[model samples]
Target: MNKSIVFLMVILWLAQGLYAQTYRKDLPDIAISKDVSLHFISPEPIQYVDISTHAIAGDLPLKNVLRLKIVPDSVTHFALTGSVAGIVTVVGESFIAQYNLRYTEGQAFTVPSQVNILPEHTRPLDVPGIALTSKEMQDFAMRILQQPAESTLRKAKAFGIQAKLNHVYTAGDHIFLDITYYNKSNLSYQIDEQRFKIEDKKITKATNVQSVEITPVWQLYPNTAFKKQYRNIYVLKKATFPGNKVLNIELTEKQISGRVLTLKLKYDDLLKADAF
Candidate 1:
């Protein structure tokens, strides 16, 4: 035997072994039935789901937030004959999962009542984005809370309630605003609406005022009622506006009392935000 031929054969054998290990045939099977449905729960929100065959169907009942529901397709005539198997792939925000789906006549004791996607069975997804997750945002907010309030922006007081902007911080592509509300009176403040908008600083009677609403991407410490004082951190995407416009933070109380507190943040105030 030639030395080169032996070396070539050894390389081919190693390559084949590596390929076999990568695509193992011993995937765990999930039993599916027309009458019985299978539910899968993921650690994070699901991004995509792919069913390899027409014998089974899958859908995100909660709009792909976290749960995936699977059922056997009745219209697939081939499923009625005998056993039908397919592959199911579920992609989540941080992980990917694959499973072998098998159609069965009826639900059996071996059938899993619910499938919880385990971290060990999933591979990490390399999603490209600078956006922070909710948990990360919340953790950042906690760090901001530890800093002393240094902002002296506009404040509002109404119906024995005082609201003010405490601090502003900038990081990457997002801005964090720390706000505090104090109830001077003993009555509890029940917040009905919390809104942010950019509007003209000065409005004339003859001129129609234009306002654009800004929605916060994340909020820390979400609560509706507070007695003495309430503090929260709101996260918003970084944006730019003209000097003539001001960011308005409005908090309206629930019905009956219907009191409103409004705070204004000028464009200059946003520019003064300290980097975290």
Candidate 2:
């Protein structure tokens, strides 16, 4: 081949190879990306407790409505959304709903990138189909029941992030936290006891407990559900004091920050008989 012709042919071949490369999509590649993520995470480790005391209300779904109830211990769905829509969303099915009691098969997968995702329980965890934490949902249920926002003291009807205290609230003092919920129901639920655990990093003896009442409030959207039940295992530090001399409520920085940690032991009882 002529030297100039051969050089031209080489250039053409290189151009073809470049064009054949896989891009974000088919058209002219505006920005190319090799940024993919892989998630190697344990199924969000939940401290699952069986319902001990069922807080049922008229708004709770009829027991007959549950096709499946056991939440599978699987890594819930996750995704990474980008801006400037040339869109192709890459996400998986909701692990909680997908791996229900009905589906006896396991369908968990790892992402391509080695990223560790810790699924923290917030009022809103991005797991599709799963709303607020079970407790928050129960708070919603309680609101539907028309429970007073304040059971004498503390705010229950307002909204705040769920956090725990760093120290075990000594048996004789007030432990405080801030919180609220949405239109939801927590069937067969229980928050039997609330105390600051020994390992929490938030609450301590030095913390303050503000004496503000948090009444459980509900902003229910029309046409949804039948009944709901929710109550924190720990609300008032001195829910039932040894003596009725004078109950004083105090607020700590931790409580004010809404990061007060409390150990809540929960239990569940299967209520498939009388639908509440």
TM-score of 1: 0.67
* C-alpha TM-scores of all predictions: 0.67, 0.18
lDDT tens digits by residue: candidate 2, 1-276: 799999987876664443232224322212211232212232332322221111101111221121112122211110111211121111222222111011112223321223222233122236543333343433534443453434222222212323222111211132222222221323321233222221222345886533323232212222122224222323332233222122221111223234222223211111111121
> What is the C-alpha local distance difference test score of candidate 2?
0.26
The residue-level lDDT of candidate 1 at 38 comes to: 76
